[model samples]
Target: MEMTSRTKKFTYYRRKATNVIMLSSSFFSAIITIIPLFLVFYYTVREGLRYLNIDFFTKLPTPIGEPGGGMVNAIVGTLILIGIGGGIGIPVGMLSGIYLSEFGKNKFGTLVRFLADVLSGIPSIVVGVVAYTLVVLPMKHFSALAGGVALAILMIPTITRTTEEMINLVPHSYREAALALGIPKWKTILFIVLKTAWKGIATGVLLGLARAAGETAPLLFTALGNRFWSTNIFRPIASLTVFIYEYSKAPFKDWNEQAWTAALVLIMLISIVSLVFRLITRSKY
Candidate 1:
């Protein structure tokens, strides 16, 4: 009887010790994950603060040898590229996703999902080459349109998979309820299913845009980068990623500072997009 009591107490303490060790390890793991993110933010702000100003956002890049300039054109070009890319990619991706979630239990759906996965894993440089061949070659110019096409291709797989997953998350009960209201299948999907899933879908789109914003290799072969201010989609345009790559590699001190500032700007842009999406998703319906 004493031996049984001793065994029970030992087992209780053993389980407690195991739980404590597990909890401690998980807590440390989280800290390890978060510390690097904080460090990167700290370094980027420290290194980039001196160069960030109204002029940096407003002026064009000065000549290479000259010191005082800004990345105004690059900022504008980045926005335009994302706009065009999102416009082209979002609709197609959503349509594909809707089909996959709602009507794709077959072999064709599996093939499409597999293809999307493969496309997402392909190197950004490879996408650039494909875009250059399809858009730049046909247009006979390295244009913002070509850059957008590359980014669009990169964005598509993300949006499609997110949309499919989010749509599936909408409980089948919701579908049944809507269908019982005498709604047609297509109408139920468009009005009920899509509206319910819009927030998650938007988050996926924003995440894709954020990922595309920092890509440089695709722009290298496709848009090919511009030196001057250019808003024309048909003409080559500058990008923040490309500008940062060029500036950071240059021997000039000022250009290097500008590169850090561009990195900060890119991070801020992505943060703002994520914040906006969060706000929209949580807003009162």
Candidate 2:
């Protein structure tokens, strides 16, 4: 009887020690992740805050050696490029995802998933090179269309994978219930399964867009860059990323300040998009 009590006590103490160790490890792991994030944020705000003003958003960028300028054209061009890319990518990605989740239990589906994974892993600069050859060579000029195409390619795999996972999370019973109610398979999938998973899919789409919006390498090869205002899809246009890259390297202190400010704007835009999508994905209705 005494031995049994001692054994029980020994087991309890051993479990308690393991739990304490695990808790301490997890606590430090979280701190390690969080500290760097705050440090970056703090550094960016400190450098960028001084240059963020009303004029920064409304006026066009000034010439080298000029006193005043803004990223108005770059901001507009970025929006236009993102819009074109999202328009092209979202539908195709969603359709591919639906097929993969609903009917991709065969060899063909396996091949498609493999290809998507491969495409996702390819360097963005390589994609930019491909787009430059395909789009710029044919068009004979750098253009926003090429930039849009590059961004779309980058977005597709992310959207496709996120969508497939979200759709699969919907219980099979939902599909079975719809079919039992005399609904056709197509209608059932379109109405029930799709509607149920739409919120999560939207989150994925937004995340993909956010990622595309921040890419610089692809735009460099495809859209190139314009310093002045440009709205045409067939013309080279200013991009926030390119502007930051150029300005941050200049000999002038003012241009360097502009780079930090542009970085802040890009960071805020990404943060907002991510937070919005996270909220949309988490909400239950």
Segments in model 2 whose C-alpha atoms lie over 4 Å from true places:
1-30, 277-284
- Residue-level lDDT of model 2, residues 1-285, one tens digit each, is 999999999999999999999999999999999999999889879999978998989999888899778999998888888888899889889989999999998999989988988999999989899989989999999999999999999989988888898999999999999999999999998999989999889888988898888889999979998989999999998888988998988999999999989989999888987887777677765
Query: RMSD, each candidate, Å?
Result: 3.1, 3.8
lDDT of 1: 0.92
Kindly give the stretch of ten consecutive residues in candidate 1 with the minimal lDDT sum. 276-285
Best TM-score goes to which candidate?
1
Backbone N/Cα/C clashes per model: 0, 0
Q: Model 2 scores what on Cα lDDT?
A: 0.90
